[model samples]
Target chain A: MSRTLFFTSLLYRSTTEHKRAIAEFCSNVKMCRLTEQVVFSDPYKISQYNRWTAPYLDEDAEAVRQDNDLKLEIAELKAKFCERAQALLHGDLHTSSVMVTRDSTRVIDPEFAFYGPMGFDIGAFLANLILAFFAQNGHSNGEDDRKAFKRYICQTIEETWSLFEQKFIALWNEHRDGSGEAYLPGIYNNPKVLQLAQKKYMADLFHDSLGFGAAKMIRRIVGVAHVEDFESISDPGKRAACERKALDFAKLLLKNRRSFVQIGGVVRAMRQVEE
Target chain B: MSRTLFFTSLLYRSTTEHKRAIAEFCSNVKMCRLTEQVVFSDPYKISQYNRWTAPYLDEDAEAVRQDNDLKLEIAELKAKFCERAQALLHGDLHTSSVMVTRDSTRVIDPEFAFYGPMGFDIGAFLANLILAFFAQNGHSNGEDDRKAFKRYICQTIEETWSLFEQKFIALWNEHRDGSGEAYLPGIYNNPKVLQLAQKKYMADLFHDSLGFGAAKMIRRIVGVAHVEDFESISDPGKRAACERKALDFAKLLLKNRRSFVQIGGVVRAMRQVEE
Candidate 1:
């Protein structure tokens, strides 16, 4: 008997609370075969589904309508991307919502967790981490130390995506109710076929990841909740410059999200940013 | 027989390597009596005066112009505002640069530390902490814990600013050099006049502090180094919404900075912001 528990809170909950809730939730999940709703569709439930929430309706009715329209378009695109990609989706994947304790890796906050486009979760998680990494300078000194921290983050991005893909594929192969649908049976199991398929999937994921990553990065730097790293820098000019760089990086990545065919390309693009 | 050290760092000497060299540099400042060239000049040379630096320019063109422009502006502003305010400055004041060890509370990162706006440092430090308080939600959680954390932050802001002002005024009263034409001897020091003067000075400082405080708050949320508090939020929409509120609060404060002639106004504005 497996019980599947749903994670409730994300923003207000601390890491320890997050961990505890996840453990309990997982225990419940193991006991029940409940299909947790990761993404909320009901307009009334939008607040419950997202971390950084805003009322769906803004002060201006027209502006609110426009924003909603934009969201709908994005959703349509997301659905399209998922359909085209035809891959195992983690549904809602982002690091803050994820919890692990030694032996088993369990996802706690699954308000939006689902199976659709695996790239969405992978991309969102990596993008957010990168944003945090660039902002780390505001909080600490020691250039060498900052560098070490960045290296750790970059490695995590690569490793997490790599491991997730490995696990997802393994799960799919083992549990796949073979239907000979759009995907080839066991093509991922073949060395040459698997390599080609992996490359293509990675390319698609990288592109989507870059787009969402840019959006997340841009919104944070200029949108709201500006990082403390720049806050610690007393010079307003220097702070402004750092912010400009982050925004620039975001715009570049978002605009070229689809053009990225490999993970190396994305890295190279990010590296080219002067800041 | 007595050695007095100013915690402020000289502008030029401040670098990544020299981040930890301020304590040593203070000793050099006292021993060398480097004030003539380092403290007051048409253009001060801090980094160049140190033996470790290589010659980059025969003269820093921008610094010379900046010094001339800033000096004139300060002198004019001082003469105007002096009627209602005190003259003392803390060039660079913010958290992460300030260190506290047991009984000692001294500012460390003061490369830009100078005397201009007395409230700038105080306001900046408080603003940084406030941002951090909100950001803590990204990692930790407990309903009561969050409530307690917020209360502690609010108290810290109130107390720290109050204490800083009291200490600053006390220092000013003790060390006021009577050489300046602005000082009319007993005209200001007379007990009856002194009370009125203190009231006015406090009012002006409080107003200026609010403006700077608002700027620090707004920029951190909308500027460069974005906070992690919202990132910790698993729900994307909610996180974004909360951040929007923070930004909105910052913008309001900045726009209404000039209106903050009374400290009560500043406090009221902050309290008015709905989160």
Candidate 2:
């Protein structure tokens, strides 16, 4: 799912001129402020636009508001989302923004597009996938239970992150000697040092992705907007159950993302959450 | 020294529109790239423009190039300098950029002004002061030794950071209910949460100031441009000794800035480096 977004990010070379041009272009969009308002702030506060399975999840939503630790973590993530211009991101890369037709996939609706942390795009896509994974239970019937489909979603989530990491490192190695400004070739050219740099970069990116993915999940469940995965479930009780599980996992992820070092661990934790 | 810069930053309320306008203005400056090159990149690598007191400190210059850990920390700082756009900065806030008189003080030479981490401006001014403190020995004589002057400089350094923190937080508290985008009153209105948020914000800024201050100090010693503090010393040995002391302190601060929690501790550390 993130392949196209990552490829689009790689299209521009990381020369000084390229970075300045991209940053200039991104500055005009005002997407950073928009994302901070919608994704990070509104959901955590008492906003009129916020909605949920009201009677069922009222306390849950209030818990999100009152979670001081959660609010603090979200503030830090919001700061990063606003401050770090790591790359060009598809500012709203949810499942609806993507169209998959077996052989090819196309991402659309870039009105929110701007320069931001790459993890936002990656995390957005993955969060939607996790939402679908959790909602599979709500859609399940007697004969066609979605246990297998849930596993498939989990696998897709893991593969998306692992593949993105592999390809990103490959691209970095290919351009290690280029005019990229992030890590100069002269300083990081030593193979051992290069390895260390890559490890640190990927680790940081992983944590960022988890933090963003969880925030995206929390916002969807409680903020003004929501996803069809849970909405499509006719039964509100079942839908709330699925959302509560997802919300629990997201709260945990947002608070303790750094403790998670790999995609597999996240998947495992997702499966362990009670529905 | 930073009074004007901080005041200028506070002039614009952090409304969404105001932030967008400032960010747009800053994006066009390209000062971020220039600082990255001169302050963070060029000195650590082999560059024709890089020079020092040559044979007098040839080994020390080479040691800077050989320190892998230093290179790694610098890369992180450079990334922050490039990526984080926290506030408007007088991009080149060194000593020469200011003009002071008995009645009033004026800041000039803002060719490098842009939206950047506030610490860059704060650190540049403080780092220049530190360099002056280290260079006092070279200018000392029997009739007028600079020991008392050095102590005065140390007090000034401590007061500069402490006062900045006090004033900045005062501004934040005064405008807590304003429409600022960084920390909304709805979410952070509680006294306890507000205190936590302020503590976190100031602590991060303090560390950033130290890191940037150290980087600025380092570039003056080994990068293309040398500072008048060390450059004016007539004796090569004396100049190298002062430069070496400043360089040693800077390297330590750069690598271990987070371990320092207070400005007083940093002032003490600056005094401990052997001259």
Candidate 3:
């Protein structure tokens, strides 16, 4: 009965049909099809679409399929992808989703928008940055110029999570007495319990974000999709080294996200891995 | 594109409206109003709808709100309720949901059916059994013993999960070569990996089931709804004692479901708590 108008630099194109489409075309379709196959399905098994640095990653990809514990971890993440509806997400938010300059940033082309885990959004953003970090070596021509850029990416990852946590907690505190039923004002209104509730909430979200982020990173290397950062490395031999590092770190992140209590620990691990 | 006819004991209403209705009316409608409160919300906060046996359960209910870990556990379960769509759950599966004859039993009115965690269904069934176990003392009169009936309920609970596990694994094994993407035939088709996958899946499911079952038990004790199992007991004091035992066991189950690997441990715990 009502019409709404909008003016913007981007057309996100949110479909009300998103959920049903996600359910219907999950095993098929376009971009969501990418998430369905690469992130959720193909990485766990030998699929024709799945490729790596070929001769280099043959064992790695096969190991992923064969490692029971690793496969178990991926299986849990896959279930979360299929089952949980925690938010409306930009399912593929790798380096391509953002248009950023010195002064402004615009997120565009969210054709994959659907109700998914909030962590998927957070993870995609963070994981892409991690991919950029891992791809740094492939970009090098025996120069340290990109060192500052790598540091900047790490700083951004750290600050992004830090600011996100602060803002999320602040909002929860502001709305503690509001209509939000997650932490009811009548029960968890007490300061100690309220803080405890927030801690656990953040901890779980952090782990989920890391896990999803890791999955995103792994898929780009081994699954059908390839990020330009590593793809443009030209020499398949050199690119394989950079990708192997990313894949290794991603596997670590996916399996051990629960052990990471803070963003700093993750950053430190990334730095150590890069070294 | 196609026409389908249905005539059966069950109605699978394939509605495009299922998700929205499930999300919107979750804690706010019909008999499901009970689930919205007891299992998902009220137990976390002090609400007018939440009532325990006044003099007996006052401290216990207060302790529940005060208990940080317990509240966190409940919140995680609530998140799963809000987020996870692991199966087509028969949501309101209390004692009231079941109808029995000598040989044939038919389950009627799956009005709360939706895509939800399988544990919620299993938990609801198991929790109702626990409720019956607790209520036996309240139903005790001076004359004949109801010990056999209580034993029967416990045996039923024990047999239920055991048979469910056996059948589920059997199905998984038979269908390991099918189109299921969770464990691909090429990778997880191996005997050792398939067995490992099943073991992990069942273990995780067992924990989830216990957590959900415990949540159901707690809500019945303190949330908006009271079951006929406890309601049939005329004496308040006796009912309170029975309810208190149930409440204690439920808290334990919710908090420590992971420590229990087998159904036998849960049965023993129930008996120990009763003692």
Model 1 clash tally? 44
TM-score of chain A for the candidates in order shown: 0.57, 0.93, 0.86
The stretch of ten residues in a row with the least summed lDDT in candidate 1 chain A is: A1-10
Where does candidate 1 chain B have its weakest 10-residue lDDT segment? B1-10
* Shift of residue A32 alpha carbon in model 3, Å: 3.0
> Which regions of candidate 2 fall more than 4 Å away from where they truly are?
A1-34, A141-144, B1-15, B22-31, B142-144
Candidate 1 vs 3: which has more DockQ: 3
Model 3: how far residue A161 lies from native, Å: 1.5
Candidate 3 Cα errors over 4 Å, as ranges? A1-31, A143-145, B1-34, B141-146
Candidate 3 lDDT tens digits, A13-83: 12122233334333322555457667867887879888898897889888878777777787677667655
> Per-candidate TM vs. native?
0.33, 0.93, 0.87
Query: lDDT of all predictions, in order shown?
Result: 0.42, 0.80, 0.74
Candidate 1 Cα deviation (angstroms), residue A261: 65
Query: What docking grade does candidate 2 earn?
Result: acceptable
True contacts kept of each: 0.00, 0.41, 0.39
What DockQ does candidate 1 have relative to the true complex? 0.01
Candidate 2 has which clashing residue pairs, if any? none
lDDT of 3 by residue, B1-275 (tens): 00010110001221223333434333323444346566777876778878878888889888887788887788788667655655556777776778999997777777776556778888988999999998887887744487899889889999989988886776666656654555656656578877777788889889999999999999999887888998888788898999999999999999999999999899999989987
What is the TM-score of candidate 1?
A: 0.33
DockQ of each: 0.01, 0.46, 0.36
Give the DockQ of candidate 2: 0.46
Q: In terms of TM-score, which candidate is strongest?
A: 2
Q: Choose 1 or 3, whichever is better by TM-score.
A: 3
